[model samples]
Target: MSFFYSSIVKFEIEFFGHENIRSNHQKTIEITKESHLTPQGDCIVGVNATSSCADLPLELKNKLKNSNSKIKFTISVGDDEFILEGRGHPELILAHTKDIVIRKSDFICPRTLAIKCDKASDLLPRTMVSLLQNPKTKGTFTIDID
Candidate 1:
């Protein structure tokens, strides 16, 4: 006989208005319910929005719309913001950038960030494992609010 084990985790990321935009830009952003498993073993996030009027350019918006993978943004322990791109499983490709931040009062546990993995081994090299393992780090992980 043969046996296999599979597990899945779901996360939510909230988009906050850009720095230059008003605190309440009043734009609408939508996320879809479709989920994917990344190669690294993380759930691929989904967003479904009919329209978004935020400051994001049309090209970027299109990119988000056409993206068939899980897209994530996070603030590293060093306070640098990064975007994690994955397809069909947790094959996380990290993109370093300066345009990410953590917002308070957005959820019950604002610091609870979600990490996706396709293989358990991929997490062995991450420092976030300890933080994510902590029971305190349990909040809805969102990518963008709008």
Candidate 2:
């Protein structure tokens, strides 16, 4: 028998934090294309994002839609860095234009970048979250799938 495997796929996005970033939501972590944020958006850690789900490369999106794919989400801000592990699902559409979300649940949605994530907004380090409350904070989000 013969088998085939796909090569690793990578995508990166840049965004800035907002003054309203709370990062308190228990189930999700999110980055949005919108420049402004309200306190109610507790899952949001970054705003004025350079890329949304709709902007992800098609190759990376394809990998993210595969049920067998493993995903690594790397977040870097100044000197601090965080790594999140997650899995892809066949249900992922990766089509939302305004937001990119990572969820700890298995729920699938247009904005969801990865489901069954190992961490959520509330699980992030408090020090990192504090830095994210400043609009001057710059962040890089890198996604790798295989």
Candidate 3:
């Protein structure tokens, strides 16, 4: 007998919000079938609560060459947390500022998320937690692979 498992699979997720808030738990996202088929390509990912440039702290905001631009996050995937900056949008996290987190289902905006790592097959178009750094933090984004 033989068994096989494919990396591509549908996903359902639960996003845990701030510790004080429990009603915001169990959030979900819907994706199209097409977004799941692309293994080594880019797909649209809806990001919530992405701090605007104006929202950024004065110190972090001042370092940017363009104050008008939005701040980009260091999109890291998997346990190793490899960075996906090259494929990311023009906005950046910059050298300073490490305080960032995603939580709940705000559906801030759908941004493009590229899958171009050696472990691409292992993760793509699936449901997973992006940033739940600690017990106090419920995480920032809930990703769903179609």
Candidate 4:
């Protein structure tokens, strides 16, 4: 018998913080491709994102569709780096064009990137959130599926 194993898939997204970034939502965190952010987008940490859920590679997306897949989401800005862990679901249809959201709840939507995330925007470090409120801050988001 032949054996097959799948390897981890990883990708990075570059984004810039927006002046309106609140990073205060209790249940979710988000990065958006839109050039502008409203004050009401309290979950948004970064805007002008280089990639949305729709921009992810097919291989990565396919792996993320597996319920057994574990995901690591890392966000780095300046000298601060934060990591969040979550799980993927078979019901995920990651096809949103403008946003990628990680949620503390199991609610799945086109914009949802991961579910049952360990941290939400409100749980982020205050220093990091302050940096994210500045439009000049550069942010890197890395997604790893294992």
Candidate 5:
């Protein structure tokens, strides 16, 4: 009789660093579920008028619709304001998330905002990203409606 035993090592890695968390912390910004502060100090924002985020400000909605091909929006975090430019696909935000089907019900055509950060790492926190993309999460960001 021969006995064979195998041990599979499952390593869970964390991508977020101190700078990444700092970049996302202490800033009161309405982040639509699509918005997330990447470990690289960058943020991914979504500009959409889907039913899920219809409650957003009218001006913001207009900007999202009229911006059309343009991918730039001014946002406020804590006291500082930044101009977020559109880069990645809106669906990319979804793909970055875990359970996308639950939150994404209707077929929404939303634009993307790829904000850059100077002090971010190439890696991100898996836990934080999970919360950002959670179905129960509501996307919100604090910006000047005027």
Candidate 6:
């Protein structure tokens, strides 16, 4: 028997908000299927969540660490609001490059915004959390990646 080797690629997204309270919300993360494809394959969408202060819940974090397929997650924070981001693998990358629409809305109360790659697949939730938790992170914040 012969097996093919596939490279695992991960794409990361960053969410920027005016304040900490404007970063946490479910409507902020959105996913839509692409229109066309060249080679054609199953697209996997993974949503990762991290907080500026602490790691996501052990259960959720463990789930992401153990998954070999597409998955999404909803994370909580100690603060009022936070930013959410997502990343995926090759399948998702193909879909994204094809001009697929992955709309991520923002929180309504404080009003927040999320940005995603139009031609890339996967999102690095861990890195995003670290970035937001930098010493420069002066305000409270949270993150969700589902």
Residue 20 lDDT (model 6): 20
- For each of the candidates, give the backbone clash count: 32, 0, 6, 0, 11, 10
Model 4 residue 42 lDDT score: 96
The local distance difference test score of each candidate is 0.26, 0.90, 0.26, 0.92, 0.29, 0.27
Among all candidates shown, the one with the greatest lDDT:
4
Candidate 3's C-alpha runs over 4 A off are: 1-46, 66-73, 76-80, 85-146
My TM-score estimates for the predictions, one after another, are 0.24, 0.93, 0.25, 0.94, 0.26, 0.21
The residue-by-residue lDDT of candidate 6 on 1-146, one tens digit each, is: 99976433223332221112211222233222222222222121212212211223443333333324333322222243323333332222121221222224211211111223222222324333344333233322222333
The segments of candidate 1 whose C-alpha lies over 4 angstroms from its true place after superposition are 1-63, 67-72, 75-82, 86-125, 138-146
Tens digits of per-residue lDDT for model 2 on 1-146? 99887598888899998889888899999999999899999999899899999999888888898879999998889898889999998889889999999999998889998999998888778898899999999999999887
| lDDT, model 4, position 116 | 92
Writing each residue's lDDT as its tens digit, candidate 4 over 1-100 gives 9998869898999999888888889999999999888899999999999999999999999988888999999999999999999999989989999999
Q: Which ten residues in a row have the lowest lDDT in candidate 5?
A: 97-106
lDDT of 4: 0.92
Report the C-alpha lDDT of model 1 over 1-146, residue by residue, as the tens digit: 99875322233433221112111211111122222212232211111212122423433334433325344433232232334332221221222121221212122121112223122212222343333333233213234311
Q: Return the clash pairs for model 2, or none.
A: none
Error of 6 at 10 (Å): 0.5
For candidate 3, report its TM-score. Answer: 0.25
How well does model 2 score by local distance difference test? Answer: 0.90
Strongest candidate by TM-score: 4
Q: In model 5, which runs have C-alpha deviations exceeding 4 angstroms?
A: 1-30, 33-52, 57-63, 67-71, 87-146
- Candidate 5 TM-score over all chains jointly: 0.26
Q: Which of the two, 1 or 2, has more TM-score?
A: 2
